[model samples]
Target: MTTSPPEPGLHEGEFHGGDLDAARRRFPNAPAPWIDLSTGINPHAYPVPDLDTSLWGRLPQASDERALAEAACKRYGAARPDMLVAAPGTQTLIQLLPRLLPQGDVAVLSPTYSEHARAWRREGHTVREVSDLDEIGTAKALVIVNPNNPTGRVLPVERLRALAADLEARDGVLVVDEAFIDAMEGSASLVPQLPPSAIVLRSFGKMYGLPGLRLGFAVARPEIAARLRDNLGPWAVPVPALQVGAAALNDDAWLQRTRVTLEESGDRLERLLKGCGCEIVGRTPLFCLIAHDDAGTLALALGEAGLYVRQFPEHPRWLRFGLPGEEAAWGRLEKVLRPQGQ
Candidate 1:
């Protein structure tokens, strides 16, 4: 399917992935159609069911929410469906968690998602971005993005269990953003026995290739889940999101096939990057990080060639590439990259 492109603009400070609608304005000289490889969203989206007109006419029903939650629990391997809180998206939960959860000196695993730290700070909490667990000394709360974005580093579940235990003792919560963990084979998920003080976030859109659906989940103890659900109020997730999310989650065959395809594509991307003299610094099946001294210039060149990849200004040496998602896109990327070997 030919997917619509994400809005484009300078990603200098805030997230430049989905919000920018001014791509033509920023890259005036570039071609009309832009290929966006900036976000880790799966390019091959789940086939959306032809939603009934009544879905649009009426407000969402409670039964619809329950069904979606049930599907999510089965999909996520969670025994406690009561612990699931369906929200507009994980981004909404990210911002809301800070206000609802206990306040403490928060430590986020650094060089990961910018939103985690930003959310806490906006709520008047002191947030520290730390690379080492030991560096998080005396910090009551901790946040980590598993199979971390940009750099696909994963911390083992046992270590996180220990951290959760420690935080629970201190009355602080351990927030694990497993947004990209769905496609991971033998995923190190902290579910089935999610610690009393631990809250795990799951993204429905990334693995299923339906980010536009704006569906995501937060799993925690019933108490935390209740707080999040109540605060989000009634009909937080729309009828459309609920329908598609349920359908996709139950489609195990699609999940299995997509994982295999993404892995193959990820390997192909690695080889392509290597041929262009880029060091494959980090990766998950969804994205690859290229380490080159002049990554900024390389990114600019790719952008000028009408491909939008993600670049972290703070980490100028790294550029993250999502899958091209089509044969033509692969050809275009190869064409642009072959000429400019790092």
Candidate 2:
């Protein structure tokens, strides 16, 4: 294999995580069955129920889609099930939101998800990457990733509520992406307290460990949700997605148990990384961010060793690792991080 530098995080859109196909191609000579620690997706996934043979042949019924919406509303503590709309994934919603809203200046609190800014810009809006809320200025729309991705920095609900109020005055919208909030402790979702001019997006895949299913939702005022529904047309969410998403959302025992498990796993990861001579910079339950002066070289080494982790181009010193699910996965990571002789 060539000893060139790696670009593991970039998919067609921009830099994010869990692109194993890109990883495998980048490190062609790395061993088979690479351990992906790129995204903040929960390693412990929700158990999917058995599907009927008929589900595949028949188109999803409107009622089944409604059931999924209700399950999501209850699961997220949304104001009303009618206020929710199911899409293929938050990526779809992320791209769709900018098109529906009046095109103008959009302020995204960054070093967060890159997709949010890119989506608005693609729709002909001036997008600004602001460091803090004070820099938002007169933007018509604001996007925030709650319990943020790599940094795991979370804003209080009150602060967010006040921001929503400020945007509402401008007839603007606040788009809060709560993709990682399921595993995030101490912070509450904005869905229940969803403001009049605010739109909250939820990712079922990240929390459920089934990003492949591509199910997600948007919680908003009834009119805004209706607008999204109209644009998306019929059958935006398929039958299997409806059935599986509803089942997963309603599983209380699994949800409660997983929350506890993720917290414990997060602490375990902290201990593991620290023991391996890495400094833990930030973390949510599903992933941890590390700061190393030589993160680029380290990332290249990890890539060569059949481990795919997220390395940000903008912040060259930062590296992000997702939780490894199984015991063997953890051992593989440890083996690579702490070689036998060391």
Worst 10 residues of 2 by lDDT: 3-12
Off by over 4 Å in 2: 1-5, 8-15, 339-342
TM-score of each: 0.95, 0.95
TM-score attained by model 2: 0.95
lDDT by residue (tens digit), candidate 1, 1-342: 222222335453565564335555656788646888878888888899898878878788989999999999998888778999999999999999999756679999988888999999999889999998998887888999998986999999999999999988878899999999998888489876688989999999899888888989999989889999989999899998999999999999988999999999999999999888899889998999888777767777777778888877677677889998889889889999998774
lDDT agreement with native, every candidate: 0.86, 0.85
lDDT at position 281, candidate 1: 86
Candidate 2: pairs in clash:
none
Candidate 2, residues 114-187, lDDT tens digits: the string is 88889999999999999989999999999999888779998888989999999999999999999999876554
Model 2 accuracy (lDDT, Cα)? 0.85
lDDT of 2 at 46: 85
RMSD of each: 4.2, 2.3
